[model samples]
Target: MTPKAILLHLRLPFSLFLMPVYWFSISQSPHFDVTKACWVFVIWHVLVYPASNAYNSYFDKDEGSIGGLEKPPAVDKELFTVAWAMDILAIVLSYFFVGAVFALAVLVYGLVSKSYSHTSIRLKKYPLLSWFIVGLFQGFFVYLSTQQAVLHPYNSLTNNLLPAILSSMMLWAVYPMTQIYQHEEDAKRGDRTLSLLLGIRGTFFFTASIYSLTALCFWVYLPLQQFLLFIVLTSPTLVFFLNWFRKTWLDASQANFKNTMWLNLLASFGLNALFITLLILQK
Candidate 1:
C-alpha cells in the first residue's frame, strides 16, 4: 500500500523489455509522424506496460523473484488502483491522440494482459496457451498497434506480415527466458510455464531452436547488408546467450535472476540497437 511498493510493483523498468517491438514496428514505416510516434511510446511504455505489470503483481503477490524485480514488493489494493489508473490514462490518450483503431488496440491489449494474470481466467496456468498468447499479443499485436499510432494512413498487416510475425518471434524468444528463473515461484502459483514443462535443459534447447529459426527468417527477409549489420549489432546478445546456455547446461542453477535479467536486458538492447539503426537508415 505504500508509495514504494506501489511504484516498484508498477515495474516500469520492465517496459524496456518490450521496446524492441515498438522500434521494429516503426522501422518498417519508412516515414512517420514523429509526434505520433512519441505519443505511442508514452502510451505503451509509460502507461500500458507498467499497468499490466502492476495488475499481474496484484494478482500473483509473488514472495520470490519475478521479472525485473529480484525482491518483489508485497502487492496491495493501491497497486491495483494504480494499474487501472494507468490503463485508463493509456486508453484515453490513445483515443484522443492516436485514433480509434489504436485506442481499441490498447484496450484489447490491456484486457488480454489482465486476463493473463486474472484469477477469473488465469491464462498463465496453461503453458503452451499462455506462451502463444504472450507471443501473439506482445509481438504481432504490438506491431499492429505501433503502425496504427504512427502511420498517417495505417498500412495493413497484409503487407507487413513478416516483420509483424518476427516481432512475435522475438517476444517468443523472450517469454521462456523470463520464466526459466521463476520455476519455483511459477509452480507455487500453479502456473505451468513453458520453461517448467521443458525442464531447464529442455528450455534452453527449445529457446535456441526457436531463436535460430527466427534469426534465419530475419536473414531471409532483410537485405544482405542489413542482416549482416543485424548480426554484428546482436552479437553481444548471441554471445552472452551462448555462454549462459553453456553454463546452464553444466548447471541448471545458473538460470537464476542475475543471468536471466542480463539475457533479457542484453537481448533487448541488441534488438533495439538493430531496429533503431534500421529506423534511422530508413530516413
Candidate 2:
C-alpha cells in the first residue's frame, strides 16, 4: 500500500471517540504517571486502533464510503501486513509501559477486533454480538485499560467500574448510529449491522433510549455540579441529533454519509471537550 493508502486505512479521525476514554479514566484516577499515560495513548491510538481499522478495511475492501473516509483508496497486501505489525507492536509496548496483564488485554482486544472482520470468524455478521463486543471493548475495556495503565501499582480493577460501565453504555447507544448510513454496503457484504437489524426508526429509538439511560447513570454517579456541566456541554449535540433525526425521518436520503460524518464529528468533539473540561476541573 502507498503512504496515503496506509493513512486512509488507519482511519485516524475515528480515534476521536477512543481518545475521550483516556481523559475520562485519567480524570477519575488518583494516581497519574504522565509518561506511562502518554505511552498508553500512543499504543491505543497509533497502534491498536489503526491496526483494527486497517484490518477491517482489508477484509471489507469497501469501494463505497467507510467510517472516517468517504473516498477510501484501494487496499493491497501491504495493508494487512502493516495492520498485524501494529497490533504486535502495541502488545509489546503495552508490556513495556504497563505490565503483562495490560499487555494481555491488548492482545485479546486485537484478536477480537480481527474476528469482527475476518472471513472465517466474521463476528460482524451477527448484529447484536457485534454491537455488544464493540461497545464492551471500545468503551468499558478501554476505560479500564487506561485507568489501570495510569494507576498500575495503586488501583484495583473495581476502582472505577461505574464510570467504565457508563462509558460502555454511551458507546452502545452511539454504535448503531454509526452503522445507520452503511446499511446497503454492510448488507452487500453479508454483514447484518446492528443498525440494519434495528431498522432506521428503531435504530433512532434505541439510541435515544440508551442515551437517556446513560444520562441517568451520570446523574447518579457524578456530583450535581459536574453532571450539570455535562448536560450543558452535551446540549448542542443533543439538539443536532434531534434535527438530524427529524430530517432523516422526513427523507431517508438525509441519513447519508455526509450527515453521518457530521454527526460523528460533532458528537465526538463535544464529548472530548466535555471530558477534557472535567479532567481540568478535577485537577
Candidate 3:
C-alpha cells in the first residue's frame, strides 16, 4: 500500500483514545516494569490497533467519514498484507515480552478485531454482538492484557478486575454513540449498526443511562481521591456532551462529522491527560 493510504488506514491518531485504557491498567497494577509496559504500549498501538484499523478499512472502503478521518483514502491491494504482517509482529512481540498467555490474548484480540470487519463473519452486522465485542475486547481485554504485561509473573486478577470492568462499562456506554453519525453510511452497507437500532435520541439516552451506572460504580468502588480526580478530568467531556446533545436535539444536522470529531478529540485528550496524571502521581 502507498504510504498515504497506509497512514490513513492505520488511523494512528485514533490510538490516542485507546492509550488511556492501557495507562489506566498500568496505573492500577502494583508492579510496573516501565520497559515491558512501553513495549506493550507500542505493540498494541503501533501494530495490533493499526492492523485492526487497516483490516476494517480494507473491508469497508468507506468513502465518507469514518472514525479519525473525515476523508479516507481508497484502500490498496497491499493493505491486507500490511495488516496481517502487523498482527504477526504484535503476537511475536507479545510472546517474547510477556509470555504464552499474554501472546495468546493478543492473538485472540487480533482475530476478534479482524472478524469484526471481515465480510464473512462481519460481527459488525449484529448490533448487540458488535457492541459487546468492541467494548469487551477494547476495554476489558486490553486492560487485562496491559496489566498482564506490566505485572508479568504476578497474580493480581482479583485486584485488577474492578477497574477493567469499569473500563469496559465506560466503553460500552460510549461505543454506540461513536456510530451515531454513521447511520446512513452503515445502513447503505446493509449494516444495522447499534446506533441505528437505538436511533439518535435513543443513543444519547442509552449512553447517559450507562454512564450514570458507570459513575455510580466508580463512586462505590474507587478510592475517594481517584474518584474525585476522575470526575474533575471528565467534566469537560460532560459539558461537551450536554452541549452537543442539546444542539443535536434542536437540530439533528449538528450531529455530523465535524461535531462528532470535536467530541472524540475532547474526550480522548481529556482522558489521556487524566490517565497520564494518574500515572505520574502513582510514580
Candidate 4:
C-alpha cells in the first residue's frame, strides 16, 4: 500500500483526540515510569489505534467524517484480514508489557469499539448510550488502562486520575456538538444519536451543564497549584467554549462544526500539556 493510503487507513490525527488523556494518566500515576509510558504510547498508537480505525472504517462507512478519511479507498480482503489479525496480536502482546489486567482493558475496549461499528449491535444508533460509551472508553477507559499498564500495583487513584477524569468529563460534555454536526447525515442513515434525542436546545443544556459540573469537580479535586496551572493553560479554550455556548445551539452549521473541532483539540491538548508539565516539574 502507498504511504498516504496507509496513513489514511490508520487514521493518525484521530488518535490525537485520545493521546493526551492517555499520556496524562501515565504522568500523574504514583507508580508511573517514563519507560512504561513510552511502551504504552507505542502500543496504543501503533497497534490499538490502527485496529480500531480499520474496524470502524470497514463498518461505519463514514465516508465524510472530517478528521477521518472520506471515501477511504476500499481495503482488499488481504488488508482487512491482516487488520483483524493485528488487532488480536496487539491486544495479546500488550499483556506481556502491561500485565494481564491491562490486557483485559484492551479486550473490553476492543469489543466495545467493534460493536459500535460492526454487526447489528450498532451502538451508535442510540444517542445517550453512544455518547456515554464513547466517553467512557475514549475518556475514562483509555486513562484507566494506561494507568494500569504503567503503574500496576498502585494503592489508590493516581494524582493524575482526578485531572484526567475531569478532562474526560469535559470532552463528554461537548461531545454533543460533534453529534449535532452530523445530525442531518445520521438521521438520513437512521442513526438516532443523543443530539437528535435531546433536540437542539436540549443538547446545549446537556453539554453546558456537564461542562459546569466538570469545572466544579476539577476545583474540588485538583491541588491548588495544579488547578491554577490547568486553568491558565485551558483559559483560551474555555473562553471559546463559553462564547460558543452564548450563541444559539439550534443552528448546527459548517462554521460551528469547524469551531467545535478546534475547541476539542484545544481543550484536549491544553489539558495534556498541563499534566505533562507537572510530570516534568515533579521529576
Estimate the TM-score for candidate 1: 0.98
Query: Which candidate achieves the best lDDT against the true structure?
Result: 1
In model 1, which regions exceed 4 Å deviation? none
Instruction: Identify the runs in model 3 with alpha carbons over 4 angstroms from their true place.
Output: none
Q: Rank the candidates by TM-score, best first.
A: 1, 2, 3, 4
- Residue-level lDDT of model 1, residues 201-248, one tens digit each, is 888888888999899999999999999988998889889999999998
**Quality of model 2 by C-alpha lDDT:** 0.87
Q: Which candidate model has the greater lDDT, 3 or 4?
A: 3
Which pairs of residues collide in candidate 2? Answer: none
Write down the lDDT that model 3 would get: 0.86
Q: Flag regions of model 2 displaced more than 4 Å.
A: none
Give a tens-digit lDDT track for model 3, residues 1-283. 6798788889998887777788788877766788888888899999899889998999988999998888988887799889999999989988997677779988999999999988999998999999998999999999998887778466668877888998899789888878989999999999988889999989889998998998899899878998898899889888998998999999998878887777777777877887778788877
Over 1-283, each residue of candidate 2 has an lDDT whose tens digit, in order, gives: 7898898889987888677777788788765887888898889988899899999999999988888889999998899999999999999999987778779989989999999999999999999999999999998998987877777475766767899998899889888988888999999999999899998888889999999999999999999998998898888879988999998899988877887788777778877888888878877
RMSD of 4: 2.9
Candidates in order have lDDT scores of 0.91, 0.87, 0.86, 0.72
In model 1, pairs of residues that clash are none
Q: Please tell me which predicted candidate would have the highest TM-score against the true structure.
A: 1
Question: Candidate 3 — worst ten consecutive residues by lDDT sum?
Answer: 148-157
